[model samples]
Target: MSAPANDRLFRRWTSRLLLSAILLGVCHPLAAAERPNLVFILTDNHGAWTLGCYGNPDIRTPQIDRLAAEGIRFTRALSSNPVCSPTRATFLTGLLPSQHGVHSFLGGERPSAQMGPDAYCTIREFASLPKILKQAGYVCGLSGKWHLGANLTPQEGFTSWITMPHGATTEFYDAQVIENGAVRKEPKYLTDLWTEHGVRFIEENRDRPFFLYLAYNGPYALGRLLLNPARNRHAEYYADKELLSFPRDTMHPWQFHNKDFLNNPTSIRRVAAEISGVDDGVGEILQVLQRLGLDEKTLVVFAGDQGWMGGQNGLWGMGDHTRPIGAHELMMQIPLIFRHTGRIAAGQTSDLLVSNYDFLPTVLSHLGLSDQRPPQSPGRDFSPVLRGETTPWENVAFYEMENTRAIRTDGWKYVARHPEGPCEVYDMQADPQERFNQFGQPAVTDKQRELAAQLDAFFARYADPQYDLWKDGRSKAGRLGGAAGPAAAPPQRP
Candidate 1:
């Protein structure tokens, strides 16, 4: 054999042997060993109430429940904005909708006209979680939905990108996927494909400290999609079981878009099936981590971009499904679980009122990178809670969706609309379901004023001037939808 050919053959064999050694725990880089890896499992439009760990009586989510049991499950984690793109942007940038300017879920199955011919990543200008981690010498990979626009390319600091063609998912099977600049229709289940890609990324990057954004676009029970029966592997399991956890109530007057699917058995089963599918993927991921000996050295965080309501208050979807933009508890709270064995305590649940805006700061703080947190972020560091420390944390969280703004305190919640006449105040302790609006009652007048003032002050301190909708600031995506109320409409930009 020629000398060049012999050298190439020898190099290939050497590379294979080294990879085998690394996988077998025989060798590991010093830098990679010191820095704990990150596995951020982000789900789409899922509510905390759907999981067993969060007290759901009907749905089957044993894997997620095990994760919660083995780590810290936050009981009151919330999203700043109860939509896809806005809350997702908040998670990545630690900025609220007013700061990031993605006021709503980005355009559907196609590129948004607002972004022009050249695709634009909505949060490109901000210091994203992936970007920050990448700068800290960690290789980052994103598998699944990247709904923040420019889904065709790797955005921010992600090097390995496998994402949906666009933000929305019309069908999980035969879905269009963009894998490393190549777009193709994936025949397999989208959820399974996302899991497969995540596993591949982990195995490929085992030698280095990596950040895996294992995003799953599943259990997205909304619109016409919910009208059909689920076809995943778990469909048979949920076929006959009555998912009573999904309330069967009289149609809420505010519900317009998803009224048809309210209390529909097929839709309920579909959602349950999807949730179990995601749970299966979670189980596989955990198994892989254990097999690779990275379970203890990695931090696995599971969270939802926003919350969803399964026929709660007779409402079937998120806040946007309502005319005045609902900020109901079921549409705000999400499951936030963190499992980092040895470093974090197990079998614990925290009641600290936290938001997705606090995610980036807390994760960075947990990894000893709090100094890299964005200056404009209002996110607080709750890493101490993760370490099983009894730290005094404030019991409050804020929410915004275009013209609507809300403040959730320990026992009170006040939702205010821009230049509004129909504001809402609910004594959360007295009425957790938010059925009564005590905004104008003479007895609750002082309490209403106090909560409203606090909400106003929070937005005033955190909201960026250029994107504050209460002050006629524009949304980066486009105009608002389902804004029937007078104050819900954005002011005319002349």
Candidate 2:
């Protein structure tokens, strides 16, 4: 059969299956119109501060900014962990790193050895977002960057999977990619290709409820990747401009890597170009939804897997870029926007403290599947807030990165290291830049003790015994050097 013929046949078959499922009473009884489709656009290593909607005047992200204008932009949305894999796992499973056992990024040095011969799916043991949605009769599709191990095959109940050959990106052009169980080098820009696949998925599944995980691994401004000038479509536009949004502060004393890229114009332009590339993709996806008349029927979510720091505090990478693994506000904050024409409120900003852990429950609740939420999840449902309701909310958020843990309240931020003497206490209201550490100061000792107790109690309630580092627990994946370089592992529990 010809390629076009095969595609037609496949679409017809899927359409028939969808119709049959509905007739057979497999779908919800509330009718297809009530069950909204989900289009989750997840970006990589991007910060909320880089977008124009987040108050960055230098970078151009008109499409994402437009989405924020039409929906709710979270001012305090943060990631549970500050790395790639751990935060991604938390986003899917709604479990913290201590519970999910993914303490750090996977497939680092021992890509093959870490996952073993068969290639394990790290989050397969948990009840993830995709699996829950699939069971609820939504056709799930993943477009890019499935870094949760087993990139070869679709994990977590996804039917359509097109992902990178590896988690990290060395170059965006002519990069290795995996599609239909085969690894090949893609000549096109990776972001565009993912968008193409995502558009196709939306078109084909328009007749039924679908979930598209349009994961873009772009704007990844880290490592030697930023050493060269960007070759994307937006390269020339940013080549001559001096983006003043990025701070020109001196190198941070805690920065242990990417020293040369600090305050470099070429690096700055490259990051801006990549971010614009992602913005282009977002624009394309939104256009398709409007063209197909599915704008109101689909709940469009734009978020980042984790946050990135572009020279803020002289830090060019994420929290793990530092030896002690700093968890500054910039490193933890991410871009979170939700849009559904008549459902979610438009042109609003919420200051409630939210994290990636809250994503799964909030999504489930928003879709009217609150009963399907996993039990004992630390995440609380924020669906009421999304609907523009005035509800009581907890004003605290906690973070964990291997040996370091931190707690953020409305006014104070306390950081605790394992078995350590060097700790930090910052009065965020007084010194938002976190310049002064009041850890041992007598004036804030009582506040510090109170925050510490709350932090300890929260972790004690949720941290799994097998993966709690403070209690000498072991990690399930490759860990960063953390307090020790990038290769040292934590001490094992007896």
Candidate 3:
């Protein structure tokens, strides 16, 4: 044999031995021994009540159920706000809409105008989660949906970005996806393609501590869910299983004129099919992590951005921005699940009053970086609660939207809205559906006064003179939906 050929053969054997050593904890967890990878799966407009783990027996979500069995399932995972842009801003910034200054949903006629430097506040000025995570030795990547603001331009900490610039595109085919400042309109299934890219990021970043934000656009609105060729995958499955049911009357005041969607049985099945697609994608992503041996060392959190109220409370479409503009139980409650091999116990459920703001501090706490927070951050670390440790956790949850504000305790919930007659108060223990309002009842004045005072006082701390709507009494008449552009569907402008 030639000398060069002999050298090549030896080098191949040498590399295999080195790889075997690395696999056997030489480079632990595919990175440093202590740092773990974080994968946050944030979905669009999915209700906590729909998941099989969350008590919905009809819907198909075995993947989400498995997370519940393997980790902690939070029953009251409140959203920062019910809407997309504002709640998303809370997730990225760990600040409220009042604190962050993105009080309403953006993206309409002028996405270019909506995404301008001064159009909405950017994360550049704030201490954001991704930026801080990146600073703490993690490679951050966002795969889908960046509605917070500045959709076209990549934010500071995301090293790798694949985003939808329009801020709202439910379909999967022939959609424009921007990758690292490059735009391409391609024909691809969105759910599959996003998981494909997410898996690719994990595969490539196994040698370092990585944070993958796999935000999916699904379960939002069935009319625009996704343009899949094989749409009957779960539609037929649901129709056959007798899974779709609308419990309310058809012509309620809260519903819109989507009669085709309302009247058709198959339409509800189509929405279920879309959610099933998300579950399938979740399973695939988990399978990849297990295959790469990263599952044990990676923390996988599955949560919905906001809850959707399909056929609940006399409503059709759901989301904070949907026509039913109220902070009902269905619109604000989101599913929050966490899974790590030994960090969080298996088959555990907690009733801790957690919100979106607490996500950053809790994740950072689990990673041993809890102190790395801005002074203005409103999040409190709930790592101890996740670990089943006995600690003083939050007793109540508070949140808001464009014109609605709410505060909920273990037994009661109080809501105040704008241009309104009487504020809403529900004995959640007795009226979980929020049907019976006892706000003005003389029988519960003490409870009402106490909760109202608590909610108002909490908002006061986060209130800035220039940014607060509650303080100025502007939350009601300040800005409602579709005034500038359509809130449900932001115009797809070039």
Q: Pick the candidate with the highest lDDT.
A: 2
TM-score list, all predictions? 0.91, 0.92, 0.84
By TM-score, the candidates rank as: 2, 1, 3
Q: What is the C-alpha RMSD of each candidate to the true structure, in Å?
A: 9.6, 7.5, 11.9
Candidate 1 at 379: error in angstroms?
Answer: 0.1
- Candidate 2, residues 88-182, lDDT tens digits: the string is 89988889998888888877545552234657777666778887777667899999988888888788889999998667889899999989988
The weakest ten consecutive residues by lDDT in model 2 span 485-494
* Residue range with the least summed lDDT across 10 consecutive positions in model 3: 485-494
- How should the candidates be ordered by lDDT, best one leading? 2, 1, 3
Better-scoring candidate (TM-score), 1 or 3: 1
Write down the TM-score for model 1.
Answer: 0.91
lDDT, residue 47, candidate 2: 90
Q: Model 3, range 1-494, lDDT digits (tens) per residue?
A: 22344346435534553454356444455333357889999998788988899988788899989988999999989887766777777787677777766676665434343344544334445667676666556899888887765666667588878887656665666778877676788687687778888999999998788899999887665554423322635666776554544454554565553445553556566667778888988998899899999877899999988777767765655444345356777777899999998788899998888888888788877876565555567788888877889778767778877556688888999876543424778999988988888878888888888887887788778754445654443221126653222223321111
Report lDDT (Cα) of residue 437, candidate 1: 86
lDDT of 1 by residue, 1-494 (tens): 22344346435544553454355344444533478999999999999999999999888899999999999999999898888889989999899998888898887424472234767888776778887777666899999988888787888889999998677778789989998687888999999999999999999998788999999999788767887888988888898988899989999998867777898998899999999999999999999999999988899999998999988889988988888788998899999999999998899989999999999999998876776677778999899999989777898999998877888999998887765436888999989999998878899988887887788788789876777777666676755664424435532211
- Which candidate, 1 or 2, has the higher TM-score? 2
Residue pairs in candidate 1 whose N, alpha carbon or C atoms collide under 3 angstroms: none
